[model samples]
Target: MPHTIRVLVAKPGLDGHDRGAKIIARALRDAGMEVIYTGLQQTPSMIVEAAIQEDVDVIGLSILSGAHLTLLPHVTRLLAQERAEDILVIAGGIIPPADAQLLKEQHGIAEVFTPGSPMSEIVRYIEEHVRSAKDLELPATA
Candidate 1:
C-alpha cells in the first residue's frame, strides 16, 4: 500500500489569520494527504508536540504576524530535539525572499510558500519532496 503523507498545518504565535492555512489544509487533503490543522495562536512548542503526536510527514506553519524569526527556529529546534528531524518543515505568509533563504539555510526549512502561491503548487511540492525523502530512507528490495 502507498504510504499516506500526513501534514500538520499550524498557526504559530499571535497570528489570528488562519484562512490561508485552512485553505491549504483542505487542498492537501483533497490531494490525498492527511492534514491536521492545529488552529490559531499556537506556540512553537505546541506545534512541534502536535507534529510528533500526529507522526506527520510534513509541517506547514502559517505566520502572517512577522514572528517567523522566533517561531520557525524554535519549531525546528524542538523537532530536532525530539528526533523528528526527518519531518519536512514549510512555512507560508508574508515572507520575503531573503527570509525564505534564511529559513532554508538556518532553520532547516524545506519550503516557504509566500502569498499568491497556488494550492496545487504547494500540494505538488509536498508530494514530490516527501516521496523522494521516503524513497531515499528505504532500502531497495531484492
Candidate 2:
C-alpha cells in the first residue's frame, strides 16, 4: 500500500496570517495527502510536538512576520535532535531569495514557496520530495 503523505501546516511565533496556510492545507488534502493544520500563533516547540504526534512526513511553515530566520532554524534543530531529520521542512511567506538559499544550505529546508506560488506547484513539490525521502531509508540503531 502506498503510504499516505502526512503534513503539518504550521504558523510559528506571533504570525497570525493563516489564510495561506489554510489554503495550502486544503490543496494538499485535495491531492490526497493527510494534512494537520496547526492554526495561527504556534511556537516552534508546539509545531514540532504536533508533527511528532501526527507522525507527519513534511512540515510546511507560513511565517510572513519576518521571523523565518529564527523560527525556521529552531524547528529544523528540533527535528534533527529528535532523529526526525527525514521530515521535509518547507516554508513560505515573505522570504527573500538569499534567505531562502540560506535556509536550504544551513537547515536542510527542502523548499521555500514564495508568495504567488501556484497551488499545483506546491502540491507537486510535496509529492516529489515525499517520494524521494521514501527512497532513501536507513535502519534504526539497536
Candidate 3:
C-alpha cells in the first residue's frame, strides 16, 4: 500500500489560541493525510520530538504569539540536529512578511502562511512540497 501523508500540526511558545491549528489539522485529515495535532503551548523541543515520534511528513506550526522567529527556527534546528531535516516545515499565523521571508530564506522553513491565507493553498503547498521533499529523501525524518 502507498504510504499515507502524515502531518503534525503544532502550536509553539505559549500560543494559547488554537482555533487555526485545529482547523488546519482537520483540513489535512479531510485531505486524506493523517494529522497529529499537538495541543497548545508546546515548546520547540516538544514539537520536534512529537514530529520525530509521529514520523510525520510535514510539520505545520501555528504561532500567534509573535515568537515565530525564535520558536520556528528552533524546531528546524532541532530537526537538523536529529538528522530529521527532510521533514517539510511550514508556519502560519500573524507573522509579518519580512519575518516570513527570513524564516524561509535563512531558516529551513518551507513556507509561511499568514492569517488570510486560504486553507486550500496551504493544503496544496504541503501536498506538492512534501512529495518533492520525499522524492529527494535521505531516508529519515518527516
Candidate 4:
C-alpha cells in the first residue's frame, strides 16, 4: 500500500480560535491524508517538534492572531534548524495579500490560504506539493 500524506495542522501563539483548523483537518482526512491537529495556543517549537516526531509531509499553520509574520517564520526557521526543510509549510487564516507574498517569498512558506479559500484548492495544493513518505527516501528503519 502507498503511504498516506501526513499533515500537522497547528494553531500557534495566542490564537484561541480553532474552528478553521479543525475544518481543514477534517477536509484533509476526508481527502485520505492523515492529519495531526495541534490545538490552540501552540508555540513554534511545539509545532515543529510535533511535525518532526510525526514525520509529517506538511505543516499547516492556522494563525488568526495577527502574529503570522512572527510565528510563521519562526516555525519555518525551526524546521530548517532541525534539517527538516523538505517538509512543506502552509498557512491559513486572516493573512493579508502582501504579508502572504512575503511569507511565500522570504520565509519559504509553500502557500498561504486566505479565508474563503476553497477546501478543494487547499487539498489539491497539498496533493501537488507534499511528497509521500516513500518519496522521501527515508531509511527502512525509519
lDDT of 4 by residue, 60-87 (tens): 9999999999999999999999999989
Which portions of model 3 miss their true places by more than 4 Å?
136-142
Candidate 4, residue 135: the lDDT equals: 61
lDDT of 3: 0.88
Candidates ranked by TM-score: 1, 2, 3, 4
Q: lDDT per residue, candidate 1, 47-137, as tens digits?
A: 9999999999999999999889889999999999999999999999998899899999988988999999998789878888988988733
Model 2 scores worst on lDDT over the 10 consecutive residues at 133-142
**What shift in Å separates residue 44 of candidate 2 from its native position after superposition?**
0.7
lDDT of 3 by residue, 56-136 (tens): 899999999988988999999999999999899999999999999999999999999998889889877987787776763
Estimate the TM-score for candidate 1.
0.93
Least accurate 10 contiguous residues by lDDT in model 3: 133-142
Give the winner by lDDT: 1 or 4. 4
Ranking by lDDT: 4, 1, 2, 3
**In each prediction, how many residue pairs overlap at the backbone (N, C-alpha, C within less than 3 A)?**
0, 0, 0, 0
Lowest lDDT block of 10, candidate 1: 133-142
Candidates in order, TM-scores: namely 0.93, 0.93, 0.93, 0.92
Give the per-residue lDDT of model 2 (tens digit) for 1-142: 5677899999999987789899999998888888999999999889999999999999999989998999999999999888888889999999999999999998888899999999989988888888887973322212
Best by lDDT: 4
